[model samples]
Target: MKITTPRWALEAAGAIGAEMAGTIAATGVRVVGDTALLSAVPEAVEKVPAAPRIAPEVAAQALYGALAAVASAPVRHSAPAKARTVHQTSSKELVRVLGHRCLKRLRRR
Candidate 1:
C-alpha cells in the first residue's frame, strides 16, 4: 500500500521551504550541501545594510534622564469622590421580580 501526501500539503511545504531559502539568502548566509567546501560572497555581505550600534553608556544616560524627568513632574490631585445612591434588593425580592417577568413572557407566548 502506497501512502501519498495531499497536493496542497506538498505545495505549502514547497512555499515555506522557498521562503526560508530566500530569508537565508537575504541574511548573506550560504548553505552548502557539501561540508568539505564553503565560500562567502562579499557582494552578498555588502548588499545587507548594518544597523547603527548604540553605546551602552549613552543608552543608560538617556534612560536615567527620562526617569528623572518623569519623577520631577508635578503630581495632579483629583477631586473628591461624590456619594453614590444605591438601591439594595433582597434575594427573595429579586426572585419574585424575575418570576413575575417569566410568567408575563410565558402568558404572551
Candidate 2:
C-alpha cells in the first residue's frame, strides 16, 4: 500500500534545503512509500572543519591557568533551602490544558 506525506513536513524540508546551500541536491523533500528522504551531495561532507591543534607550551599554559582559577574560586558548603513548594503534574493536565485552549479557539470561531 502507498502512503502520502504531510505537506507541512515537506514545506519545512524545502525551507531547510534553501538554507543548506550546496549540501542539498534537490529543492524539496522526496517521499517514497512511507519514508521521507533528503538527498545530500558528497562534496558537502568534505566541507567540514578539520581537528584543531595547539603548541605544547600553549597547551601547558592553558591547563595551568585553568587549574589556578579553579583553585582560587571559593566553594559553597551546601545549597540554599527551597523557597517555594513544588507541585507535580502529569500528561493528563497537559491534555486538559490543550483541550481547553482548543475548545476556546473553536468557541471563538
Candidate 3:
C-alpha cells in the first residue's frame, strides 16, 4: 500500500494493461485485483465512450477505499455442529445400545 511514488499518482507498479481493463467508468463500485475490470465498469457508464479522461487523485482514493472495503469484509464460515462425532464403543456397548439380535446379525458376516 505504501508505494515509493507520491500518493497523488496511485499507479500500481505491477499493474499492466490494467488501464484497458477499465473499459467503463464504474461509480459506487468495488472489485478485487484479479477481476477488477468487472466492477470498474461504472454503473450506467458508456462501455466505449470518447477519449479517456484522467482520474483525479480524489477519485482514485475513493476507488481504493471502496476496493479495500470489499476485500476486507468479514468472511462467513460454517458454524460448528454439536454431537458431530460418532459414538464409538465396545461391541458390548454397541449391542446394548443397538439390540443383541442386530449385533448377532452383524457378527455372522
Q: List the candidates' TM-scores in order.
A: 0.29, 0.24, 0.20
In candidate 2, position 28 carries an lDDT of: 60
Best by TM-score: 1
Ten contiguous residues with the weakest lDDT in model 1? 36-45
lDDT of candidate 3 vs native?
0.43
Over 4 Å off, model 1: 34-109
lDDT of 3 by residue, 23-102 (tens): 33344355445545432322332345455365688787775555444444433223333523234334443334344444
Number of clashes recorded per candidate: 0, 0, 2
lDDT per residue, candidate 1, 20-93, as tens digits? 66666779766666322222112212235545488889897776555445444443323322532223444444
Better of 1 and 3 by TM-score: 1
Ranking of models by TM-score: 1, 2, 3
* Candidate with the larger TM-score of 1 and 2: 1
Residue 15, candidate 1: alpha-carbon lDDT: 69
Best first by lDDT, ranked: 1, 2, 3
Error of 2 at 74 (Å): 0.4
